[model samples]
Target chain A: MKLETTIQGLCASLKSARAEQKIIGFVPTMGNLHQGHLNLVREARKKCDVVVVSIFVNPIQFGPNEDYDSYPRTLEQDSQLLETVGCDYIFAPSVEQMYGNKPRLTNISVSNITADLCGLQRPGHFDGVAVVVTKLFNIVRPDYAFFGEKDYQQLAVIRQFVRDLNMPIDVVGVPIARAEDGLALSSRNGYLSEENRQIAPMIYKTLKNAEQELLQAKPLDEVLESIKVALTGAGFIVDYVEARSLELQKVETFNQDVVLFVAAKIGATRLIDNLQVKYIS
Target chain B: MKLETTIQGLCASLKSARAEQKIIGFVPTMGNLHQGHLNLVREARKKCDVVVVSIFVNPIQFGPNEDYDSYPRTLEQDSQLLETVGCDYIFAPSVEQMYGNKPRLTNISVSNITADLCGLQRPGHFDGVAVVVTKLFNIVRPDYAFFGEKDYQQLAVIRQFVRDLNMPIDVVGVPIARAEDGLALSSRNGYLSEENRQIAPMIYKTLKNAEQELLQAKPLDEVLESIKVALTGAGFIVDYVEARSLELQKVETFNQDVVLFVAAKIGATRLIDNLQVKYIS
Candidate 1:
């Protein structure tokens, strides 16, 4: 597998791949690869002729008070995991390489969609995500880009961005990979204490139970309240638990494509999870 | 030359071109097919294997009170002009074809650089320009995209967008094209009456005189004042006349790369022009 640390090197490689008529698939991630990231790489490997994975802990995406400095960086282990998953190229640019001497003044803002859920709690988080993802998409010039459904709002925002911008890339959302105990895999899970780790699975469990309750025609507000109560009862600080249309807009009826999204804090670690649920009337 | 009005058709054609390893150069314009627009096409033609021209009078770029309704649509004549210039394709998507049922909610904003000159007069103008140009860049996926320096701040904003986003395409800023009378060519120039047309050249003349006066080492404030006064004296309603760094930053000294920008109203028509200058100590 080829490893590229600079945008120039990645483009040079992609140019050659384009010459040879290769279908490139890109999986962009903040490294410290878990099974979830590997699953995205595996999805790319299944679909495209070449798979390129980018591992950069994007500083801009984290809020100033959030975990920018504390974010994990395990490049060596991540590289080995990617190689095992058959990723063809690993683009691991340094912070300096990604952002030069001056901070970027260009921003891509997706309105409406980014005004809810995680976007509300973490302001400018998705804008930072939007900008860096756009930069990576331009650099990779991939035919297909894979993102995890674990970040449901982010996936929606990216899809909206690509559609609105008329970008050539096809964004595919991979299903959220979970632990055997049902906890959604996340790098931030590293911050969990052993006691908090024992409590994390309950967040996903409440979401799954909420999905079932939704099928029983419980009022969305009641179902949401139940989920929030359940999480809080289990020592999780509830951020929000709501049912939304796939567009991230609040939906009253479960008649159409809707997702149940949950964000809560277990001790100091914040975790998010979502489940797509359908109601048959 | 192929004419595509649909995004799907354009992408299909571009896919074949990519397969054949053609280097596409794109020139996006609001179609009235002036000499200035053709100059951008010519620049693309000189460097690329294929030249694609998109004539979209982007409504979003015009302020609510601006001249969007009166913007010319001369596609047939524009296509004839593009053919004469060896443009390989003309993408003349209708307003409906370009933007579907809903208006775009995604915006690309370049801060600091877009805060001066024309941006001050036309709020949300550069944002609209940035969004549409980004959309065009993605749709065409050209190797090189050309813009005229006639819109100096626009060129600078685009450069910043491309650099900050790390878009794969190289943005080429073609030098401004002017009429024999030295008035900078613009589609809005069509709005001028015969009497206004006769007086329009003075805007350029005042800018030229100011450029010459800058070599005399006068303070920038005095130089700017003189140019504004000259335009106002010539029956023009001056918007602003200022000297700024090439990056569109306000500059106190003309010691480095700087551009003098001018905007004025000739009767009902608003006109803008700029000149790059260097000072030798």
Candidate 2:
């Protein structure tokens, strides 16, 4: 596998790949690869002729108060994992290589989708995500880009962006990869204390309970209340538990595509999870 | 010229062009097909293997009170003009084609630069411009994108965007095309009354006057005030006339790369102009 750190080197490699009419697949991540990320890479390898994985801990996505400083960086282990996944290229750029000396003044801000859910809690997060993804998309010029639905809102926003901007990229959403205990796998999952890790599974459990209630024809409001009550009952500090249309992000009766999402704090660490319900559409 | 109204057709055509390793040049315009726009096409023809011109009268760029309703739609004339310029393809997608039923959110925001200039008069105008341009860049995937320097702040914003997002396309700024009378060419020039048209040259004349003063080692404040005084004295409602770094958008001394820009209203019609000054760098 080829490892590149500069844009020039990466583009040269992609250009050679494209010249052969090779289908290019890309998986963008913040390093410290877990099974969730490997699953995205494996999916890319399954679908495309060449797969490239980028490991850049984008500073822009984290808010000043968020885990920017504490985010995990497991480069050596991540590189070993990528080689084992049959990845073709690994792009690991230093911050200076990606961003110049001056702070970049232009930024991308997604509206409607970013106005609620995680966007509401961490402002400018999606904007940062959008800008970096745009940069990576341009750099990789992939035929298919894989993202796991573990970050449900981010997936929605990115899918929205690719459509709205008419970007010539196929953004494919993979199912959320989970740990043995049903906790949604996240790089941030590493930050969870042993006790908090035990409670992290509650986030996904709460969503499952909400999904089950919707299946029973519970009113949307009542189902939401029960999920919130369950999470709060577990001593978790709930940020928000929302049931929104997977496509429109509007409150909907459980007769259409819906995603029941939850974000909450267990001790000092925050966790998020969601489950989709394709109701009788 | 190949005429495509849907993105699918355009991309399919572009794929063929890419397989041949042709460098595509793109000129994106809200079409009224003024000489300023034609000049961009002509420049694109000279620089690229394939030239694509998009005639999208973006509704997002217009404010609720602005002239979106009255915006020109002369596609036949526009296409004929583009054909005359030897443009390879013309993308004239409808509002529905560009934006699906549920429009995906936009993410391009240009700040501070938009704060004091025309943005002051038309709030959210630059944001709309940035969003539309990003969409165009992604769709066209041009090797180089061309813009006229007439929209000085817009050129600055887009330049920053391509840099900040690390977009692959090189943004090339062509000098502002002008009429024989030295008035900068704009489609909005169509809205000017003949009486206003005659006085429009005053905007350019006053900017040139300020450029002359700066070259004579005059203070930035003195040069700016002199231009404002000249325009207002000429029965024009002066908007703002100031000098800023062409790159950084800060009020810079008369020591380096700076652009002196002005905006004013003659009757109800507003006009803008600028002069780029390269001091001893």
Candidate 3:
């Protein structure tokens, strides 16, 4: 298992592997490796000749008021966990090394789709994600790249970008790895207060209830209203409870290609979750 | 020479070439192949084991009122020209084939540099160029890509984009190919009347005179004023003339990385040109 820090060093290592026609499977993440990230690495290991897991807490992706400075930097633990999971390389680059100078530009932005969801809440957030992912995709040039569906909207946007730009890599999306209590694993979960942490599971529970209600042919709007009621009842500030197309970001009335997405503020910590619904006649 | 209109066929051909460790050189053009495009193909043949040329008159780069429909479609002639130049592959895909039912919603924008120059006059022009270039780059996956400095600003923006995004491909800037009369080769030249065609050489001649005058260490503003005077006197509508950094898009003093860029309207035909100048104290 090689541990590299600079882009040049990592490229040197991968160049040799590429010469041998080795298929590289990459999982790019910020360095707060939780079960969700490891799950992506595990999936990569299962499919490719070489596995590269990059831990870059890309500053560009964080907004000015976001937790960029306070974002987790547990590199040592992340490296050990990767090694335990039989990972081939861990690329840990400094902010300067990763972004040489403030990138003078941004890349492929999905329009109104992103404009509403998390995009509206965190302005320029998806732009940062799009730019950094493009940079990483170019740097790695992996045969396959993995992303856990824990960041569902991100997964959708990236899929759109890869197809839009015709980037030649298989974007393998793994299912969201969850805690035993059904809470989706996230790096931000570490910021949760002990009391807020107790209520985090309810977010997922509300989504599950919405899914069950929709399964009974409840109107899409009514299902959303019910979920909003439940979340607000639990002392949460509901950002939005809406149904959108899984592939396209269109607001759906008939529930075709629909995914119920939710975001709420639970005692100062913003949490998000979603459930996929297959609408049937 | 193989002619492929589908992405799959091109991919297969390029993939086989890659397996043989062949260097693929790509020249992405907009189909009405002139002497300028032939020069690119010839250069690719000289330097690379395989040459791939893509002819896509991208609609994204054109303004709402621009000549998307009137743009020349000389595919048969273009292929014959490529074959004469020893080209290996020609990729021509329809807009529908290129962008599926749900076009992937990603943007690959260059930056502030592009937003000026042609980008300023033709809004979203560079964005379209960036997106299509990205798509072509991915599809061809060429080791080296060629661009004509005839579209001087576009070449500079692409260079900046590839550098900033850390994209892994060598971008070769080929000098503008001109006619004996010093008129720059452009497909759009066909749109001009015979009288306007005769006066087209003035665009190049004016820039040359500006280059000669600037040898006296004249301020850029003065140089630009002189060029604008020469252009307007020649019955041309001068759009803009300014000295800007070749790397950075802002106005810069002499001895910096700079190029004198100009855009003008000759009758109904719009033309752009530039000259790189050095300051010798």
Candidate 4:
């Protein structure tokens, strides 16, 4: 597997692959790889001739008070994990390399869709995601880009970005990979203490129970309230626990595809997860 | 010349052109087909094997009160003129074809540069231009895209967009094409009465005089004030008359490349023109 750290290097490599008419698949991520990110790579490997993974812990996506500085940087282990997963190229650019000495002046914004969910708490977070992903998409020019459903709102935002801009590439979302206990695998999960790690599974458990209740035709509001109460009762400070359409739009009644999203703080680490449930009437 | 009104047809044509390794040049327009738009095609023809021109009078660019509805749609004449210019393809898509049935939720915005000039008077105009141009760029995937410098701010915004977004295509700015009387050619010129048409030359004339004044080392502010006063004195409602750097940023000194821009209303028609002057000192 080839490792590229500069934009020019990666473009040159991708250009050669394009010359051979290779179908490129890309998975962009921040370093400290988990099973969820590798799942996206495995999916890409199955469907594409080449798979390129980018590991740049984007600073712009983090709020001023967010854990940007403390975000994990295990490049050595991350590289080994990618190699074992049969990844083709790893683009791990430095902060200075991705964003030069000056701040970026361009921004791509998706409206309405970004106003709800995790967007309400992390202002400008998705805008950061939108801008960086736009740059990466241009740089990679992959035939298919893979994004994990773990960040469901982000997947929806990216889909909207591609649709709105008429981008030629396709966006594919893989299901969220989880721990055996149902805790959605996240890089931030490493911040959890031993006891907090044991309790982290409660978040996903509550979501699964809510999905079951939804299947039984329980009231949407009641299911949401019970999920929130259950998480709060388990000592997690719940940020949001609500049901939304697959497009992340607010739905009055759950008669279609809906995802129950959850964000909560257990100990000092914040964790987010969601489960999509189809309603049959 | 082949005319394609649908995105799929144009993409297929351009895709075959790409396979043959032909260099494609694109000129995007709203299509009343004046000398200025033709000049862009001519520039494209000189440098590329295929020249595709798109005539889309984007609705999103125009404010609710602006002349979007009244914008010229001279498809028949425009097609004939493009054929005469040896253009390979003409992409004049309908509003619905380009934007679909629903409003576009995605927006591409360039900061700082777009906050001034025409962007100030026509809010969200550059955003509309950015979004549509982004779409056209992706669809055409041209090796080179051409723009007339008469809309200097729009040209600057596009260049910024390409650079910021890392678009693979190159943006080339052609000099403004003018009539023998020195009036810059524009589709909106069709709105001018014969009497207003005669007075329209004064806009370019004033810019040229301002350029000459700046060449004589006159203060930038004095030159700008005089130009605005001259246009207003000639029965025109001056929208803005200012000097800016090539990037459309405010210029406090005349020691670098500067463009003198003017927008004014003559009778019921509004006219805009610009002249670039290089500073020796």
Which candidate ranks first by DockQ, i.e. highest?
A: 1
TM-score of chain B of each: 0.97, 0.95, 0.96, 0.97
Q: Measured against the native two-chain assembly using Cα atoms, what DockQ does each of the candidate structures obtain, in the order listed?
A: 0.88, 0.71, 0.70, 0.74
> Which runs in model 2 stand beyond 4 Å of their true positions?
A202-210, A218-220, A232-235, A278-281
Cα-based TM-score, every candidate:
0.98, 0.93, 0.95, 0.97
Off by over 4 Å in 4: none
Given candidate 1, what's the lDDT at residue A111? 94
Which residue pairs collide, candidate 3?
Answer: A107-B107, A108-B106, A108-B107, A108-B108, A109-B107
Candidate 1 per-residue lDDT, tens place, B20-52, comes to 988999999999998999999999989999999
Residue ranges of candidate 1 with Cα displaced over 4 Å: none
Task: Report residue B84 deviation for candidate 1 (angstroms).
Answer: 1.4
lDDT of 1 by residue, A24-135 (tens): 9999999999999999999999999999999999988988899888888899999889889999999999988888877588999999988879989999999999999999
lDDT of 3 at A13: 92
After TM-score superposition, the amount by which residue B193's alpha carbon in candidate 3 deviates from its true location, in angstroms, is 2.3
lDDT (10s digit) by residue, model 4, range A33-130: 99999999999999999999999999989999999999999989999999988899999888788777754667899899899788999999999999
In candidate 4 the C-alpha lDDT for residue B104 amounts to: 70
B1-281, model 4: which lDDT tens digit per residue?
99999999999878877777789999999988988888899999999999999999998999999999998888999999999898999998888888888657788888888887788888889989999999988788888999999988889889887877778888999999998998889888888999888888988888888888988988999999999899888889998888888877788878899888888998778788889899885
Give RMSD (Å) of candidate 4 vs. truth: 1.4
Model 1 residue B220 distance off true place after TM-score fit, in angstroms: 2.4
Write down the worst ten-residue block by lDDT for model 1 chain A: A248-257
> Measured by TM-score, how close is model 2 to the native structure?
0.93
Q: Clash totals for all models, in order?
A: 0, 2, 5, 0
